[model samples]
Target: MRKLNKKLFSILSIVMLLLLAACGGGNTTTESNSNTGEDGVLSAKFGVISYLTGAGAAYGEAITNGLKLAQQDINALGEVNIELVIEDSAGKADQALNAAQKIMSDDSITAIIGPTLSTEFFAVAPEVDLNGIPILGTSTTVDGIPEIGDYVFRNAVPESLAIPAAIEKAVERTGATKVAMIYGNDDALTKGGFEVMERTAKEMGLEITTIETYQEGQSDYNAQLTKIKNTNPDLILASALYNEGAVIMDQARKMGIEIPFVGGNGFNSPQAIEIAGDAANGLIVATPYFGESSDPKIVEFNEKYEKEFGKKPDQFAAQAYDALFIYADALKRAGSSDREAFRESLAETKDLEGILGKFSFDEVGDVIMDVTVLEIKDGKFIEFE
Candidate 1:
């Protein structure tokens, strides 16, 4: 009986050792084979940091919808398999930083998309670039974003481009001789827009009557609006996010300031019209995408997007949609899911056909695309005549 017991114990110990060894081997294989599967198909995981809840929820929702739609289309192609690990930053810089750190901790993550706003991107981009992870900004349009590092890129048209276009159109249509500017001073996006608007207004020979400032989330803009009204400038140039932009326009209308408003990119969202209602009329802004375009790509995207989301795609959604395809194209060109290879391929992207017209990235990773100046007439955006 003693001999039998000793033999049984030895067998059990050997089996346990073998099981432990197998499990260890499996972990190492998973780490090494992160970019591909057993079938030899290239696969990559991307992280998405978005402000899914907060004042900027509309922007985040649109971005999420576009990305999801693109994901479905990309995976259907069967050339590669892509996965997104989405995190909600809630429009806060600290939350955005935390999300970035968490996403970068995974060694297998090939790239990241968004933190929605430029301020959020600013808080997280430097650290992400230092970690060697490529981070793409789908909706951050503020200037100097690409200046952070080679690893950082943005598909959103910068204020330096969009604002000037809108201001020029406003000057041509309204024959404005002077302008009153109001911008959210606390946020990077609005502040950047204001700087561009100021420079462009001066260059176009328009006098700067008054420059008023407000912070984000401030409800009472009576003082600033009163000062702007007193100036009696031909046009009101506003640099603010959708929430603040809507409120400002509403308050201005209520206060009997009936002049047309030439706004920055923050005015591009449909939510602005929804929130401000009739006050949104006569608002002009520049964008790279509009749902009314007759272009084949735009038409097709609109149909499919409307079917999926039960609403017409907005500028933010369209940009995010194109951004995913841009990443997919880079992945295919790289021929591997390696981060360095993907970055090189992405930097070399040029003249890729997308919903936003001929898309390309400049040397600094800013977008090169066409801009259209549109005005809200009867609560709908139509090309400014």
Candidate 2:
């Protein structure tokens, strides 16, 4: 009887040890990279939705380059490893929605970086916001962007600020009394830009000679340019995307309109200079970034970007770079990748000196940064005095 009792006790002890080992294995498996890394540090996944092809590809390329540079710098710090999942929106709203949906379904991406243009943002941001995912718009500047939801934010200064400053600068520089306007009728961004330019022109007591409209992707602006030429206004205001803006500028120059062209946010791209060539010269636009800035940070970023991509960084690149760093700072401060917590930290961002300049978010999630008027001179965009 004593031998049988000892055997039962031995069997019971073996079963308990096996059970404890199973429990320990379970804990170890869960601790090893199940969303959070070892030591309770968060590993985050981020999505970048941009136009890798189609009409908006230039802007997308720049934004991607900036994001990649930021990703490299952030990873070098080794605090958190950010996995960037890229999606090509192809400059289509439907594609943007599809990309955002795919990224969101991963259940790992803590936030989204872009949908490139404001139109894409308008199409996809509301839906993503409904899903409770945070989206940072790197180049979305139109009004009603952040109004999509609490989850929406942007680093680009809106037309409300950029357009007025640009127009005011043009007016002051030329002492122009009459101006004509052209804008894309099919999109919110150009239309919004036109509205702001018109309002600011009126406020400055300048008369609008004519207001013309064009559809995006239209190669021929001769019809509009012919009408604008007839007006013979002191200046011309163009609110258009880069491709169309280039076409318009080229056609205007061919038509012999020598007056200075005051451009909106859509004209704030290096492609404008590339496409318009000599025509792009004297084109003035307002932006938050100047490639030739004397700031060491800007200089370093420019050198690195040029060395990496063989082209200087433009406003799009600068803004996207700033957006990612903003996200990183927020992620670090929140101490966790929880969406809500990180978002709160992002909202509190103030006085962040980035490549662009002093960065801060207003109550509406638009960036409050210095707007510098720039002119295309000798194949480079330089700050206009």
* Strongest candidate by lDDT: 1
Q: Which residue pairs in candidate 1 have backbone atoms (N, alpha carbon, C) closer than 3 angstroms, thus clashing?
A: none
Over the stretch 1-385, how does candidate 1's per-residue lDDT look in tens digits? 9999999999999999999998887455235537777687788888999999987698899999999999999988988888898999999999999999878877788999998988899999999999988889999988889999999999999999998999888888889998999999998888989999999988888999999999878999999999999988999999998889999999999999998999888778778889999999989999998878788889999999999999988888999999999999999999988999999999999999888988899998888888999898998889888
Name the lDDT value of residue 193 in candidate 1. 92
Could you give candidate 2's per-residue lDDT for residues 1-385 as a string of tens digits? 9999999999999999999998887443222224567665567878899989996698899999999999898878887778799999999899999999878877667899999988788899999999988899988878778878888899878998898888888888898999999999898889999988889989889989999999978998899899989988999999998888988998999999988888888788888888989998888999888777687998999999999999988888988998888998888888888888878988888988787878888886777888889998887888887
Model 1 ranges with Cα > 4 A deviation? 1-30, 254-256
Q: What is the C-alpha RMSD of each candidate to the true structure, in Å?
A: 8.6, 12.5
Worst 10 residues of 1 by lDDT: 25-34
TM-score, every prediction: 0.86, 0.84
lDDT of 1: 0.90
Q: Top model by TM-score, which number?
A: 1
What is each predicted model's overall lDDT from 0 to 1?
0.90, 0.86
